[model samples]
Target chain A: MNIKHSLLNIFQDNPTCWQLILDQALYGYLISQKNSPENFYINPALQEHLKLLLTDFKSEEFSFEIKEPLEKSEAKSIKTEAYFFLNGKKIASKKAHFLSFSFQQEEFYIAVFSSEKITRANAYQKTYDVGLAEKLKISEKAFQNNFEYGATGMALVSLEGKWLKVNKRISLMLGYTKEELFKLTFQDITVPEDLEKDLSLLKRLLDGEIDHYQLEKRYYHKNGSIVYAILAVSIVKNNDGLNLYFISQLIDITEMKRAEKRIKKLFKKSKEQNERLENFAHIVSHNLRSHAGNFSMLLELYESQLDEEDEIITMLSSASSNLQETIEHLSEIVNMHNSIKNTMESIAVLPVAKKTIENLSSQIQQHNLKITLAVDASLKVKAVPAYLESIFLNFISNAIKYSSPSKASFLEVNAEVEDAFIRIDFKDNGLGIDLEKHGHKLFKMYKTFHEHEDARGIGLFLTKNQIQAMGGKIEVESAVDEGTTFSIYLKKTT
Target chain B: MSTLKLTCIIDDDPIYVFGIQKVMDVINFCESTLIFKNGRDALDNLSSIIENNENIPDVILLDLNMPIMDGWEFLDEFIKIPSPKKVYIYVISSSIDPKDVNRVKRYQDVKNYIIKPVGPEQLSTILKDFKEDNFS
Candidate 1:
């Protein structure tokens, strides 16, 4: 048979034959070189010797095959067994190849064999065939895709304050396109006030002193608006354990920040309102008790002073009237402060002022006041009906009460729209107050600046409280005896 | 028992002042009376009396809410005056607030807090206390 065809036939029959031949070839070469023996061959008588050789080699089985006829070999040989036995058990039964060579025209034959399982050896070799580079590239692509399309904004910034890479979400959050963001650094978009804090955190990260940090900071958007975000950053290192870059994650929190501000404002406003109410309560308690205590004491005196009956009676009546007036004043203040809600309406200012003036017509005529009404007939304001009537009555009557006695009194009522307010000015040529002496106490309850018996000190106090409850304000400009202008600002009804 | 040599009244309300004056006369509560509209006038008058070596009032009835220099401010300034006599001050105020009542404790010169209007009987009782205590 042809040598090439026989070798191919053996390989097709048992693919494990090549591994067996390579192992045996190495063992045979080492044994022959180390022993330095004469020419060696296999024979039936040397079969025991080959078994001994196999035992020395620590193999469980052995097999051999040759393409040339056994008779053509000049060296000693044995009838080649397809299976080799060790200790009375057939240990080797796989087909193997043989090599026939001549040294000085004497032929020699060497057989290759193995005793191990074929399947286990092939599994060990297959493990090394996997391409690690291709596997790494596939996994890296998956991670990169996740980072680029994440919902939260992610970025990698170098130690030199430059943005190396930024995800799509960061560009969208800052109102900039990806190309525009790449051209800018993190410092360019940071709010001026928040840049210092962000830089310090980054420094800490670069020093490897902290693993990560988070802070709420403001960033400037491309449109020049503020974007609030909770920024979290961590350090990533290179193979040499040196500073590489920073990985930053940002979450938008602008809406939540606005809600927090609104809540704080409301809390402050309510606190101020509560303080005012407490002051009002103290005033009521002090004023009312004083008057009632005086009345009771006077009535007690009336019993013992029967001899001066007329005088005692006059005193008692005056005390009673004073008590009545105080009670009325307290009630008016309580009503004004308590009726702040569900009572406001759009009332025509001209009609209200006219009616108020009509009610005080007798007082107006007594003062010899010339009244000029410049208020537009269609002007309206947001106020409670009774409060509007009371406010107008107080202003008109106050003008008459303090009218100048040296000259004929002149009164002017005018209204003009200003922004969201309807400003009504009640100008009068009256005995104006020395505001420097009494300005601080002008709106304080029971504070009297004038010596007039009817001043009662309650009109302006009530007027101020009522206007404030309706979301309005009152201001007075005056010089002593020069005349006073009381400007009332009320919310205009549209 | 000796009556009060002189008594000072510092208040702004005319009605309360009138009632107190009548009650004092009916009971002859003091030998003489000195009245002032507010704390500032009382402080000025008392300071002058000290300067002239005149006799200061044995007792002072002070009101809390006055036009100028209220009772608390008066007490703050009054204790610093170098006077020969120790004048007892009684706080006569219409305030029933516990805060005002508590504030009176801060003044060591204030002897008592009387609520308005001081009745005739209450005045007689105060005079009797002064007589028994010999204005100590």
Candidate 2:
């Protein structure tokens, strides 16, 4: 036998005197001499060293002190016994124990201890048990790998939330390198808004209030962008009811948040669309029935007055004209409803207003109605051009139609920017309405609230439909004999 | 129905009033047909007739949407009166809203809702349903 200095071949390749000396020293301090592997592996180099070392001393080396009895069945997830190592060495001597478990056949007992117990095991066995160490090491690595790449951002923290170890994926998610993150603590990167929540949960975990908890939390990245994540944290407990560290898994949901916002907007628009369609059906049914009823009435009149030759011609003509007007009104309502369903075009408010005024210039001059238009150049509205023109022309004509003959007609059209919208207020000082009572019925079809001979009450109703189709709104404010002001709100296009 | 002494036209429009009255005279719908401009005047006249113990009209032509008071309001007040007999009242309007027709159907006193302008044929058809055979 020869003496060896290298630790690589200490157990199998070469059994040196120094290695044997250290091994006997460790074994003697742990298990004295019950039934140990040391008794069987006593050979030339180690035996020479063991015998030489004991040549001067004279005492039994070790004995097994059992802290707890072993159970044959429950050898997993729990330890059955604690084997303490007592030594008189250069460092401070303390009782270091290992949690023990029996082997598969109960013929052997396999013990689990920390890497801190590496030096103490040399006496118990000359071989390092490389096969088992490699297997255990590989399994730990695999477990860490699976968690690292998952959607969850994982981390290992000391009991107090110090970042002991973190994966590359987690570092990427927080916008930091792994080396930089390992230096900082988990609490350091956590957003201030999420700090209180995390700490409170940690307190509960420390007090054994809960084993696990989940939260939708935010963390600050190295680049200062907020990282939104759904965090799931679990506590790793030590043997004596002490926390080892925390394991946190984070699922980032920033894209999900954006998608939720988009869906909510779509839902609101669809709900509004659903309501508008419901109203459209009712309006369509109402218009169709009125025309049908009027036609039937005209026919009834023509039939009954057929015997009266003197008044037959005139009555028939009147009945026919009324029927034709009813049909035309129905067609117009249906056509307007259909047009809005196709598409909405984008147009500038100022140009549209100018064009509308120019087209109705003759009528404006005919009524001698003074029109004051103050539209901002910055305002752009999305709407069908003709529909917009028609909406404006209808209001303008109505301003002239229902104007007070006694006073000078004054129609002021002015627009201003509102919140995400442009509001054009058409204020007239001619004739007003008793809106306190007839306000609700103003938009209803064929609802004649005024004595104006031309007031079929259809113009304002159609105007409302057109505006709504083009993503706009119109509201009226009126007084009986004072005046009327119609405010039209249109969404501003970028 | 019992023999009608007076038939009343309660509408705001004169043209519609004249047309219906002429149709009624041609069919001889009722004797001594009276006309009221609004429901207020009709209710006032009816209240006076009740005070005087005069007979209510055998057939009443009521317009639903009108100035001062409407057909629905007239029915509300007319039902409050302890009438000596059942009076057949018909609602006549140019409004073809189903809600209006359905609403008038709720009132038991309203015999029918006539779509306007009120023609002599519909009046004749309604008169055929009356118990009195004066027209025949």
Candidate 3:
């Protein structure tokens, strides 16, 4: 009916043309009786092609099956693209034409088999492969640039500890060239004392015990100097979980380490000098106070024995009292230095402030200052009891002593719990300090702001030392002739 | 309360000892007084007094810092002795150190800690407290 069926019948009827068709290069030919599907002949060229594509290709075991039914009178042909299997194992896919016809009297079948030809889809696949190769080349160039120009030293090491690749920074850090570094393993450049630790960590990484490791290690520079670096290392693995290479990055810290050593040496020297100074001050204060005490006692005894006040005795008595006062102040400072050894305890702030205010009640009443204590009853601070009491005494007394005579003065003592500290504010509307001129020297010894008769200038200095010894700090806010606010931050007790 | 029969002073400073003794006489602090230059002299004399079963002083004014033995060492040895009388010990020192003051409170025999230049007022308070303890 069709030209294709007519040509197929003509080819099937002529046995001479069958040989010509079997000799074709574009297709492989196979002939079989219609009833014997297992017995067939495979052309030599296709058998050679099968031997290349399959695990084992045997001509004797080759078989064919025509899934479409054949009519009884006219010739029927079927074309199919199917997979060929030998002994249940897939070999290859082939396009085949099966022509069922009567050659003489019995029915016979001729099959034409061909490998898949190169179509437009295959051509596109070929171009896609070329594009993938070009992209891979560009990415490899980018990787090379990163490895070569990175800031820190980088290296790729083999599993056997051999240096596989090294960047320029690694070469410079080790005082070796890139070519020279590759000839040696990382162990060769590492300091012997640090080798064992590095090797053990690397072993752990290789054993899958740790994903990565970082350590401060030492390496020997080419010039025999010790180089300090912070080394971070991780392993690269293949899809099959095989050890590929180690990626190591090293940051130089030799300068930092040298500076740290210098700082420590200086700190030790300063601490020793400070201890000696403290001891000297302690001895001086102790001896001076003892002599001053005896001098005052003798002066008092002399004055008591005399019926009338002697001018010389009175002058000596005043001098002795001044001497005693100076020595007392000196001893107080020396004692403040020793207060660090005192034990700290949590004491309620309100009770201590209340007691201090009560002790200075006469002075407060004399000054006619309204002293309002706004400290919470529940708030507590961590401090040495004596230091805390002295702190409160110095601030409250100073407030009373500096109260303004022109106006009704008010001193507000407020305590609030802040972050990790108890902030106590001693704010007084009194004769405020000229902080612009005296701010820098406000807390220095013997630096008095006002000409008040009782302003010794030692109170603030002593108070600051005591506060600091208890791990606290003091801040002052003042304005001339207006007011002064002293805020002390003490450790809050949970 | 009646006056104490006897009082003892143990100090290293002669000036301080002289001043205290004069003040005691002026205040009519006790009927009699015994003095030692340091804690060692007082400890030895007190140990002898205890051995003889004589009248131990009613009050002991102990100074902390001394040449041979300090007041702390004297108290350590005196408390070990089994005495016939209950003597009240008071630590009087020039040291205004809180540590020294707090250390004195640890001794049961120590009645109080007094800072020096004790003058008349502190001595009067001590005498009154002693009379109170005796008569109350």
TM-score for each prediction? 0.47, 0.41, 0.61
Which residue pairs collide, candidate 2? Answer: A32-A62, A32-A63, A153-A250, A433-A479, B1-B130, B1-B131, B1-B132
lDDT of 1 by residue, A1-494 (tens): 78786997888788789656544332221111112223333332223334332423223333333333444443543433344445555543433334445546555555433323223334234322333444556777986997799889999888776778988889888998877887888899999999999888888887877889999899999999999999999888878998888888999888898899899999999999988976776667566767676776667677577765677577776777677567656755665565467679998899998888888888888889989999998788999998899999988988998998999889899999999999999999899998999889988878887788887788899899899989999999999888999999999996
True contacts kept of each: 0.64, 0.21, 0.36
Give lDDT: candidate 1, residue A423. Answer: 99
Cα lDDT tens digits, model 2, A437-459, are: 88988888888777888888778
lDDT of 2 at A204: 92
- Top-down DockQ ranking: 3, 1, 2
DockQ of each: 0.27, 0.10, 0.43
- Compared with the true structure, the alpha-carbon lDDT of candidate 2 equals 0.69
> Candidate 1 — which residues are off by over 4 angstroms?
A1-142, A145-151, A158-164, A204-212, A287-494, B1-5, B12-31, B37-41, B47-53, B66-69, B76-86, B105-109, B119-121, B131-136
Pairs of colliding residues, candidate 1? none
Q: Identify the leading candidate in terms of lDDT.
A: 3
lDDT scores for all predictions?
A: 0.76, 0.69, 0.83
> What TM-score would chain B of candidate 3 score versus the native chain B?
0.95
